[model samples]
Target: MTPSARDVSGKPQGVRGFSGALWHVATRAPAELFSALEELPPLVVQVLHNRGHAGVECIREFFNEPVLPHDPFLMRDMDKAVSRISQAVRDGERVCIYGDYDVDGISATAMLIETAILLGIDVCSYIPDRVDEGYGLNTEAVEKIVKDGVTLIITADCGTTADEEVALAADAGIDVIVTDHHHADAVPSRATAVLNPNSPDSDYPFTGLSGVGVAYKFVQALAEEYPEKLPYPETFLDLVALGTIADVVPLRDENRGFVIDGLEVLRQGHRAGLRAIGAVAQRPIETVTSSDIGFGIAPRLNAAGRIAHAQLALDLLREESASQAEQQANELDALNTERRQLTEDAVSVARQEVGDDPVVVSVSEKFAPGVVGLAASRLSEEFGVPAFVGTLIDGVVRGSARSPEGFHLAQFLGRHAELFETWGGHARAAGFTLQPVNLPKLRAALVEESRALEGDVFLGPQLHADGRVFPGTISFETFQYLDQLAPWGEGHDQPRLVVENVCVQTARLVGANHLLLTFREVAADIRAIWFQSGQHQADMNPGVRVDVAFRLDLNVYRGETRLQMVVDDVRPSAGERSLKE
Candidate 1:
C-alpha cells in the first residue's frame, strides 16, 4: 500500500495513543509524485509540503543553502537605539543593562553588555531577582539602578511594555533604551529608544526573534559604527542560538539563519563559560545540535534563575576564567537537579487541584514562583488542558499559563486585563500577576471562556507525523536522507514517520519506566526505545502486530553508531494476527 493515502479525517483523531493520546498523520504523497521527485527523498518532500514549504527556492534554502539575515537597521528605532548608545559611550556615562532572568534574558544581557564594553563604556548589568522582582522591570529594581548613579539604562529581553518603569527611570534623569522581543501592542513612549520587531509599530522583515535575537540585532547595528573594535556578529551567535532555542521561538526565516551559523560557532568552544556548562551537562560542545541546547544546556542556565539568583547565570556566561566558569557550571547543574525535584513535587500537589473543568487553575504558596511555570507545563501536558499555576508572594499572586494551539492565552488574559496587574506572553504561553482576591475570578473566567471555544480549537497532546511509511522503507537509508534536514525546532519539528502492520520481536522494561524492544519491521538492524512506555509492554510483546510512530536518532553504543527509533506512540494493528501466521 502507498504511504501517502489520505485518511478519512485529516484532523487529529484525538484520544487513541497507547499512552492515551492523539496521533494525526499527514496525508501521503501520491505514487506518481514519487517518480516525479526521484531526485529527492520522497518522504522529505512529503514532510516539507505538510509544513507549507512548497516552492523550490524555499525548499532549497530550508534543506541546505545558507540564509543571510536581514539588515539590523531595518527594525524600527534601531538606528535611534544605536545612535543613543553611541552617544552614551562617547560621553563616558555609567550605564546599566536591565534584563530578565530566563535563558533568553541572560543571553541577551550578556551579548548587549559585551557590546557596550567593546565601545569603552562603563557598563554594569542588573538581572532582577526572580523571586523578588518577577519577570520584567519592577519599580524597586529601577529605583536601585537610579540610585547607582546611572545616567543611561539599556534593557535586554524586556522593557518594551514597561511604560511606568521607563518613566520612573526617565524621571530620575536616565534615558532608557528598551530592547525586547516580547509581544506588545504599543512601545513605551518615555524610553529614548524601543527596539522590538514584534511591536505593532515595527516594520521589520521578521517578527519571530527571541529576546537574544533582538539583542543580537542591536549589537549588529552598533557594530557597524566600529567594525574594527567589535568582532562581526558571528562572535555571539553561540549566545543567540542558545537563547533562541531555549525560548522556543520559531526556527524559520531569519532565525533559521542564526541557528545554522550559530551551531558552527558553538562547536568552536570559544566561550569558556558555555563550554564549561556543556561539559557539566555531558554534551559534547564540539558537535552540539540545536536540540542539545534546548534539552541539555539551556535548562542549566535557566536553573540559576529558577532556584536562585539568575545573576549567577549571567556571570557564568561572561566569565573568562576557566576555573571560575567550571565552578559556576557545577553550581547551576546542582540547581537544575533541585529544580527538577521541585517541579515534580509541585506537579503532584497541583494535580489534585485540577477538576473536570475544561481548564486548570491551581494556586498555592508552596509553589515556587520560579518553577510554577514548569508545573503548569506538566499539568497542561498531562491533562490536555490550559494550566494556570501560581504561588502567593507578599499578598500578590504571580503565575504562569500554558495552553494548546487552539487556546490563545495572551488574548484570553488581555480580555480580562482588569484581573491582572501585568500580563504578557505569546498565544500558547504567558506569565501574569494579579491580586490574591482575583484568583477565583480568573479561575472561573478561564473555564467559562475555554468551554466556549472547546472542540479541536487548541493544540492538545497530539502527535503529528510527517506521513505514513511502508515497513520496508524504515531503514538506515531513510534516516540518512532525512538527517540532511538539520537544525529543526519549533516551526521545523523533527520529522516523524508512522509504520503500520509491524510485529515486535521482543520487548522488555528498562530504566524504571522505559521500553527497550527489538522490532522485526525492517531488514536493517535497529532497536526501538519507547520512553515512559513500560506500562504498555503486555500489549506489545512478541508476535503482536502493531502500528508505531517514531523519529530517527543516531545512537552510539561502545563507539559504534547505529540508527535507532525513538518511538512516540504504539497501538494495536487494525486487525488481529492473520490466519496464515
Candidate 2:
C-alpha cells in the first residue's frame, strides 16, 4: 500500500534521537557516559546506547559483526513449550495454529506453520476474522477447530486472555499451547503451556519480544531438541524482522538481534511476498530496512485485516510459488488503497464528532469495523489525546483505541470492564466490545477518568543534542562513522544530529508534504527535507537563523549520489539555551 504521510514530532539527528535519550535519562545513564558520549557525536552514541551497545564488544555483538545468541531457555517457556510441541508431533495429533489479525500475528502464524511443516507436522493455521471473529480466540472458532480434526492448538499472538475459549477447547479434549507476547491480566487456565513474557511466572530474558519473536523461540527450542529433523531456525529471520518492526516492539536485547539479522535476510529478497510488496510499494527490495517494513510493508499487510480477511496477508507470506505471492501482493495492495480511503473517511467523521476535550471518545455506527483502530490511532495523533473509535458489529459495539503518554489505555479501559463484553490490550493500544446502547456510558466514563489525571501528563517534545557537528564535520568519511550504527528502530532508533546556528538559505514546499531547505553552518553546506512540515514554510523564512535536529542521508538522483539532511524540527534560537551544546 502507498503510505500516507502524517505529521510527527521533530526527527532528531543524534544519540538514538530524543526518545532514545529520554529513555536513557529516565533509566539513569551515568553522567560521565552521557557527557563523554555527547562529545563523540550525539546521534551515533545515542543509537548505540539505546541498542544497549555501550562499548566495543556490545557494538560488535549488536551488528552481528560477531555472532551471538544467549541461551534459548532464557526465553520464557522455551524448553517446556518445545518439549510439548515435539511430543505432540510425535503423537501424530492434528494441531491448529491460531494467530491475531495484525502483522505480528500473521507473521507468527506463518513462522509456526513453516517450522512445524519442516518438523513433519502439517499444522493447520487459523486467523480469526477481524470484522467477524474480533481479536483473540472465540468459543465458536475453537469448536470449529475441534470439529476439523485438530487435537492440539498452537496459538500465536493470542489466546492468552481466552481462558473460556481455551477451557471450551479443553472440554472437547484439545490441548492448547499459547505463544503470545501480549500483556495479560492474570494467569489463564486451560492452556497446557502459556509462553508469554509478560506472565508473572515467566523469566524470559526479554519482556519486549514481538509475537514473531515468541514464535521464533518456539522454533529455536525445537531445533535444539531435534537438530537433524529441521533446518537451523534462523532462516525465518526475514519474517521475524517484518513482524517485529511492524508491531513496533522494543528493538533491544534479543529483539535487536532478531531485527539486525532479519534485515539482512530481507535484503536478500528470499521471500517472494516481500519482493512483490516492495515492487507494489515502489521501494527498492535490495535495500530494505526497519523503516521500509514499518512504513512501507506493514500497512499493506494490516490493510488486509482492516478491510477484509487477515488470511490474505498470511496467504501472501505462506505462498509456495512466486506467481501466487505476486498475485496476493497485488490483491493486498488494492485492498489497502480501499482501506486507506475508508480510514480517511472514518477519521474525518471522528474529528467532527470529537470535541476539544483533553480526551477523545467517539463512536460511529457507520465506521468500518476493520479500520476503527487505525482511525482511533490517527485521531489520537491529530488531537494529542487518547481516543476510542468504535463501530457496531452485530449487536455489540466493537472498537479499537490509541492512547497518549501516561494514559495507560488498557488499564483505564479495564477499570470499566463491567460495561464491556470483552476487552484486551497494553498501555498504548487496546480493544473492547459492549452492547451498542452502553457506548454513551463507556465514553463518559473514559472521558471522566481521563480528566481526573493531571494536566500536562505528557512531557512536551524536546530535542536532544548528540553533540555539535560543524558543517565541515559532514563528509563521506564522517558518514562512515554514522553508517556503522544502523538497523535502528523501536527500543532503539535512528540517530538525531543537533546542528546549531544553521542559516536557512532557502525553504519551500516540495512534493505533497515535504519541506525542502537549503541550509549551511560555518564550513558546511547541506540540503534537507522536513517531511510533512511543509505547512510551516510561512513561519520559517529564508535567511532565518535556527537550531535544527536532523539526520544525514544520501539521495541519488540522475545516477549522482549527494548528501542530504532529513530535518526533523527547527526552532528559533532565542527561546532558550543552545540545544546543540
Top candidate, metric TM-score: 1
How good is model 2 by TM-score?
A: 0.85
**Local distance difference test, candidate 2:** 0.76
The lDDT for every candidate, in the order shown, is: 0.85, 0.76
lDDT of 2 by residue, 281-369 (tens): 76667888777788778999999898889999998887768888888999989998999889989998887886646667777778989
lDDT of 1 by residue, 1-581 (tens): 22232333453344366876677777665555555556676677777777777665556666566688889999998888888977887899999988889999999999888888888989999998888878888899889988898999888899988999888888999999988888877778898998898888888989999999999988888888778877676789989999999999999988988998889998999989989999898777998888789889999999999999998999998999999999999999999999999998899998887677878888899998889999988888877789999999998889999987688888898899999998999888999989988988998998888788875465346677787777777777777777777788898899988887788899999997999878786654788899877889988879988878898888766768888889989866766534323
Off by over 4 Å in 1: 1-15, 30-36, 455-460, 576-581
Candidate 1 achieves a global lDDT of: 0.85
**Model 2 lowest lDDT segment of ten:** 17-26
Off by over 4 Å in 2: 1-43, 46-68, 74-79, 443-445, 448-452, 459-479, 520-525, 556-560, 573-581
Q: Find the 10 residues in a row with the least total lDDT in model 1.
A: 1-10
How big is the RMSD of model 1?
Answer: 2.9
